[model samples]
Target chain A: MSSRVEILNDGGYRSDGRRQYELRDIDIDLSQQGTADGCCTITHGLTQVLVTVFGPKEAKMRSQTLHDRAVINVEMNVLPFSTGERRRRARADRRILELAATIKSTFEPVVQTTLYPRSQIDIFVQVLQQDGGLLHACINATTLALISAGIPMTDFVCAVSGGVHSTSPLLDLTTLEENDLPHMTVAVMPRTGKVTLVALETRLHVDRFADIFRLAGDAGQALHKEMKRAVKSRATRLVGAMETGMKPPMGGADAFERDVVMEDKMSF
Target chain B: MISFASFPVPSQNETQGMTRHHPDVEDDIDMDEGFEEGFHRLTSPGEPLTSSQAFMRGHGTYIDNDEVISSVAGTVERVNKLISVRAVRSRYNPEVGDLVVGRITEVQPRRWKVDANSRQDAVLMLSSVNLPGGVQRRKLESDELQMRTFFEEGDLLVAEVQAFFADGAMSLHTRSLRYGKLRNGQLVTVPPALIRRLKSHFLSLPCGVDLILGLNGYIWASKHVKQSEQEGEEAFDAEAVYSNKNDDIDDATRLAISRVSNIIRILAAHFIPLTDTLLLDAYEWAVEQEGDVKDLLQADIGDAMIATIAARD
Candidate 1:
C-alpha cells in the first residue's frame, strides 16, 4: 500500500479534502432487493455493499447448527468487476474470510440471539461494487440485512476506518485514501458506543489507539443513522403491496350492471 | 415514476413558514402542472456522514453527534431523518388509497403479480381493474380486455397501493383513469423512500430547464414544457404521462431536452449520485461553455469511462 506521500502539511487537511476524523460521502439504499428477507446497499465513498438476509429458520447445514443458540452464517464476496483495474474472476479470496469473521463477531453480541433458539440466521453480503473499506462495508451491510429481516437487535452496528494520512488521522478512508493511510477499520454499536470489531491491517503507534477508536466509533454512529433512515423509507413504500381491495374498482359489476346507464357516445 | 412539478418557489413568508409537517404541496404527491423550477444550495449537516448515516437509517435516527444535532425533534428514525415514523416499524402497508406505480412480472387467471420493488408479489386482481363505462358493470369482458391489454411481463405500470391480506402480501388496484400500464417512455426508479417524502418534485431551474418530475424522483426533461406550468391544474394520468410528448413538443425543444437528458443519462450511467437540482445546474453550466463541457466530463468521470463513451460517440 504505497502512494501515501504523507502530505507533510501536518494538522492540515487529508487527501480527498478532509480534516482529522472526517467521513466520506456515505449514502445508503436500505431495500435494494425484492426477494431477500432483509436488505440494504451501503456506499462508502466508492465502496458499495449489497447485503441480503434469508432466514432465522432452520439451519441449512447440520454441522453448523447449535443446540440452544441461534447460529449466524456470514458470507462476503468481492465482485471481480467492482475494482477500477481488471482482476481475477474467482470466488471470495482470503480478505473476505477475515471480513466474514469480522461481521460475525461484530454482530453476534448485539443480536438478541435467544429469541430464536435452535434456528440459524444467515446474513449474505456481496460486494456488488468495490472501492475501499471492503471489510467495513460488509460489516455495516450485514447489520442492515439483519435489521430488515426483523431479527431482534439491541442497537445498530456502524463501522468506519480511520488512519494516519498526510500526518492527519483520516476517518473513513476511500480506496485512494486507504492506499496512503496506515489504518484500521472499527465497527461500533452506537447505543453502547463500544467497538465490537476492529481490524488493524497495518502497524501503527499504540499511544493514539484511544483517539482512533473514538473517531471511528462516532463515524460508525453517523453511518448507522443514514442506513436506518434509508431502510425505513423503503419499508414504507413496500406497504403499497398489502393495501389491495380497498377501492373496489370493478366490484359493482354484479350489482350495478343493469342500472339505467348506457350511452355509447363515440365508441372509438 | 416521474414527477410533474417543481420545488415550490415560495413567497418569503411561505418559505419561512415551511415546517416539517407542513410540507410543500408537492410533498407526498406528484407534481401536476403546478410546480416551480428553482435552485438553492443548502449546506449539509456537519460531519461528512455518508457511512454512519447508513446505519442511522435502520433505527429511525441519524447523527447530530459531535456536531450536527436533530433540527427536528421527533422520534429518531435511523433511515430517513426528514420523514419520521414512516418506517421504524411498518407504518402503512400497501393500501388502496395510496397512489403508486409498479411493474408487471406475471399475468395469471384473473390477476397479475407486480414487482412493486417490495418483499412479495403485489397481486393485481381482475376485479380491481377499472372498466370504461361507469354504470355498465359486467365481468371484465373480452372486448374490454383487447382494448386495454397494456401490460405483460416486463411491462411497467402506475397503480395505487390497495390493501394487504393476513399473510403480508399486497393486493394492488388500477381503478381510476389516471392509473394503468405505462409504455413508450423510460422508467427511472430511485429508492422508493425518496419518492414518498420528497420536499419538492419541481426541478430547480437555476440553470433554466423545464423538468417534469415524478413523485418517485423520475425526471422527464423537455424544453417545450419550459417556463414553469405549461397548463394550469391539468393533472396528467399514467397513460398520458408516459406518452412521447417530447417528440411533438417542437424541434428546438426536443434538441434541448434530449441534450439535457443525454447528459443526465451519462451521469447516471457513471453512477453519479445527484439531487435533481444539482444535475440540472451542472448540465446547464457544462453545455453553456463548449470547452468547459469537455473538461467537466473528463474531470469527474475517469478517463477510462470517457474513453469507453468516446469510442461509441
Candidate 2:
C-alpha cells in the first residue's frame, strides 16, 4: 500500500479524525456479569478484551518451581467467534507462545510474587473482538484480574501499540492500522512513568524510533491512570465481600502501598 | 385459533424492578405460563393474604361489597393492608429448607460450591453430602472425590438446604435419595422467586397422575396420591387454627412455606415441558416394550391414573 498521503490523511487527521496522542473511546467496567476470579471488560474503539484472574492460592503441582517467587501463568483464550468470518483455535501457536512468554517476563518484575511463595497465579486474557490497542487492552484487563484475585503488584503496567504514520507517531494502532505499517507496543508503570516493557514487532525507520517510543509511553501513562482508578474503585466495591477479616483498607497512598497499587493496577 | 380478546399484552419490565415487595402490586398475576418470572409466596396457606384496600369500619370491618369487583377475584380470603391468594404464588428468595436443582461449579477441598437455588453461590460441604457406605467424616480424601464423584463443573444436582451460613448463602445436602446428581433429564431454571410451596411437593395435574417432588423441589414422579391415601388428610383449615393458636411460629417458618408454595406453582406452570418429556418418554418406552402395554401402564400406576388415561384416550 502506497502512502498516498491523501487517502491516509483526512480532516488534517486520521480517518477517525482523532488528533495525535488522542485515545479512542474507552468503556471499562466490572458491572457486567461473567464468571471469573476477576473480570474486566474493556472496549477501546471496537477492540474488546475479557480478562479473568484465578489465583494467589497455592501453586499448582506442575508450575511450582523450587524458587520462592510465585509464577504468573497467563493463558490467552481467543474465541473463534471473536473475529469476523471465523478464527482458528490456537494450539501452541507462535503468537500465543510469544504473547504468554512476553507477558510472564514483563509481569515478573511488577507482581509481588514473593509474597505468595510456592503459589501460582493464573491470569486468563481473551480478546473477544479486536480493533486495535490489544496489548493495551490486555494490560488493562490483566490489572483488573490481578485486583480481582487479590494479588499484590508494584504498579499498574499500562501499555499501547503505536505506529508512525504521517509525520507523527500514532497511538493505540488497530489491526487495520497495524497491517500496513510498522508497530510497537510500549508498557509503562503509570505512576513511575517508566517503560517497563517494549516490543517492536515489525521494521520501522531507525530514526523515528525515539518519536514512536515517546508517544507509546505517553499512551501508557494515560492508560495507567485510567486503569488505576478502575482498580481502586473495584477494590473499594469488594469491601463487603472480603472473607478474611477485612484487607487493610486502601485509601491514602503510602510509599510501599502506592508501589503495590501501581504495579497491580498496570499490566499487559 | 387464539383469540386476541382473551390474550392481554404484557407490560414492559412487569417482571423486573420488583422492589422485593411493593404496595399497589395488585395487578392480575397471570398464573399460567409464568414460572420463569421470579416470584415467591411471602404468606402461608390459610394465612389471609392482604392487599391495599380502604375499607370502612362498619361493625368491625368489611370489603366494599358495593364496588363491582370485576378486575379482582380469587378466593376472597383476606381483607387486610393488601390482598394475596392461596391459589398459588411464586418464590422470591432462597428459602432454607426447600429442595433445589443446582449446578456444581467449583469442587473445593472440604466443600463444593454450588449455585444456590439462585441469589448467590452456596456451599455444599462434604459433610452435607450422602457419602458412600454411610460413613461420618469431615475432610474429603482424594479417593472419595473420585468414588462418589461429589460434583464436577457442569453437573446438575438436586440437593436440600442443610442450613444457611452467616453470609445468607446456604449449605446444601444430598444425603437423602432425592438429593444427588440429576441424570437423564433436561434442566429448566425458573426464577427462585415464583415457586409456590405447598405442604407437599406431590401435585395432581389435570391429566390425573400425581407428582410429588418434596417441599425442597425434589421431584417424586408417581401417580397422584390416591384419595384414600389422603383419607385422613388434615385440612389446611387445621393450619389456620394452628397458626392462630401458635402465633409463636417463627417468621422463618412462615416465610419458608410461602417460598415453597411459590416454587411449586412456578414448577407446575413452567415444568410443562419437563413433565412432557417425562411422560412422553415413559409412554414411548412402554409402547416400545411391545408385549402388553396395559400391564406396563398398570404396573407402576395405580388404578386411578389408568382410569383417567383410559377416559382421556
Candidate 3:
C-alpha cells in the first residue's frame, strides 16, 4: 500500500515483468581468489554474492576445533552499498550473525566434516549486491566453493526464494516484491530431493506455506542443474590444464619409450 | 636397479608385443581400446560411476544403493579395480619422501606443529630431527625443554614427509643437512598440483638464487648457499642448521630473489605449472626486459612471460 510501485501488475506480472514462476538469470563463476582454497561468485539477477572457502586445514583457534570432525565457521559481510540505500552493518550486527548462523546450520549436515578431524573449514560470504534472493545466492555459491575446494559432500545444495502474493504464489521475488509479500527460502539436496533448510521470517497463512515451500523446492532442483553444469565445466577445465602440464616434456627418452609402446600397440 | 637387471628387456618386449597382438585378451583389452589414453572422464558429486560389485569405492567416492557414486567434483581415475576421484584443487596430500616447506604453528612438548597447507598440521617430532652435534643422538630432557631453540613458533623449515600418523596427519623429518630452517628469502604458496615431481627439487639458479620447490606448494626462494659451505666441515653443526640468524646477503642476490619470487607469483596466478625449465625460461625473459622485477607482476608483462614460455614449449 504505501509503496507506489505495484508488487503485482494487472497483467499477472511482477514489477520486473516476470510471471509467477519465472526466476531470474543465474550466473556462476568458480575461480580461485587469492589464497582461498576455493571461491565462487554467483549472481541471481541483481543479487550477487562471493563465497570463499578456506581450510579443512589447521584450525586457527584451539577452542573451535572438534575432536572427531571439522568445525564450520561462516563469516558474512554485507557491504554498505549492497542495498539500494547505503547503510553499513557492523560485523557483529544481529541480522548479519543470524544470516551467518542460518548458512552454517544449512550446510552442517551436507558437508562431510568428519573426513577432516580437528581441522576447520571457513566459509566467508561477502554480499556485493542485494536484490531479493540474497540467501539463495549465498547458499548456492557456498556449495560450489566447497566442491571446488574438494571438500566431500553428500550432494549439491540448491536454494531458491518463493513468496505468496495475495492469492497467487511467486518464485524468486525481488527486493521490492519481497518487502511486500510473505516469502521464505528453501534449500534442497537435489540428489535425494530432501529439503535441508526452510527459513521463513515473515508470517504466512498455513494454506499458502505449503504452496510456496513446494514451489521453492522444485525451483531448487532446476537451479541445481545449472549449478552442476558450471561445476562440471570448471572441473573439466582444471583437470585438462593439469594434464597438459603433466605431459612429459618433449625430448626426454622416457617419453620416447612410452610413445614407442603406444605405436606398437596401435599398429597391432 | 637390481630388479631391472634381473628382467631382460628383450624378453619383456617380446611378451608385450605378443599381448598387443591378441585382441581377444580381456585383461589387455583396456590398453588396446585406448581407455587409458587422455584424462579420465570427470564426474560430479552424486553422479554414479559404476555398480558396487565391479568397482571398489575410494577417496572422493561413496556407495549408495549398490552404485559407486562420486562424492566430490573431480576427474574419475581407476587403478585396476580401485576407482577414485582426484580433485582438481585440493589441500596437499602428503606422501612419503615428499619435500615440504611449512611454518611452525605451535611448539608442543617434543614435537612442532607445522602448517604445511595440508588438511592437518604436520608433526615434526624431536626424534625425527638431526639435533646439533651428531646425527644419532639419544633424546635428552634438555633437548625437550629447548625445542623452541630448534624450531620456534612461526619459523619456516624445509623437511621431508617421513611417514604418517594414525590419523593420517603427516610426520615430517629434517634429518638431512639439506633440510632445515629456511631464511634469507621468502615463501610463495601456490596450488600443490602445479608442482610436478622431478628428479631434483633443489635447484640453484644461475642468478644467485636457490629454489626449493616443495611438493606442498610452499616454494622457498633464497640466496644461493654453496652446497659444500652449507654442509661445512661439521656435517651436523646444530649451530648452523638450527641457527635463527640469516647470513649477510648482497643487494644483487636480494634483487634476484624478488625477481624469481615475482615470476612464481605471476605464473601461479595464471594457474600455470611450475617446472625448473619453465621457471628458468621465465626468469631469462624477465631479465631480458631489464625492467624492475616488480614490473613482471603487471598484467601485460606477466602475460608476455607466460606467452613466451608456452611458445618455447
Chain A accuracy as TM-score for every candidate: 0.82, 0.82, 0.92
Candidate 2 DockQ, CA atoms: 0.01
Clash count in backbone of candidate 2: 48
Give the higher-DockQ candidate: 1 or 3.
3
Expressed as tens digits, the lDDT of each residue in A1-268 for candidate 2 is 4744332465546666676667888777653223233456788888898886755533445445425666688888777877766978765888877876787777888776764455567787888898766776787777656654444455567778888874567777766677777888888876456677888888888888989888788777666555644543443332211211122222324323431121222111
Report the lDDT tens digits of candidate 2 across residue range B57-123: 2111122233212111112223342333221111223567776767777787777777543324668
TM-score of each: 0.45, 0.45, 0.88
List the candidate 3 regions with Cα displacement exceeding 4 Å.
A1-3, A246-268, B1-38, B232-234
Q: What digit string (tens of lDDT, one per residue) describes model 1 on residues B1-313?
A: 2221111122488436534333345335322222112211111112122344333333222343422222111122332433222232221235445555566777777788776644445778877775444414576567335533545677666666678765455788876543555432334544333333223233323333444344333444434332233212234333443342333445444455555655554443333333443344445444555543334434344323333333431
Model 2 docking category: incorrect
Question: For model 3, how does the per-residue alpha-carbon lDDT over A1-268 read when each residue is reduced to its tens digit?
Answer: 4578987888988898899999999988887777789889898999999999998898888987887999999999999999999998999999999999999999999998988888999999999999999998999999999998989988899999999878899999899988888899999999888998999999989999989888998898788878987887677667655554443543354433531122111110
lDDT-best of 2 and 3 = 3
lDDT of 2 at B268: 30
Better of 1 and 3 by lDDT: 3
Best by TM-score: 3
Candidate 2 — which residues are off by over 4 angstroms? A1-11, A32-35, A63-67, A236-268, B1-313
Model 1, A140-172: lDDT tens digits are: 777777765655565667778887743346677
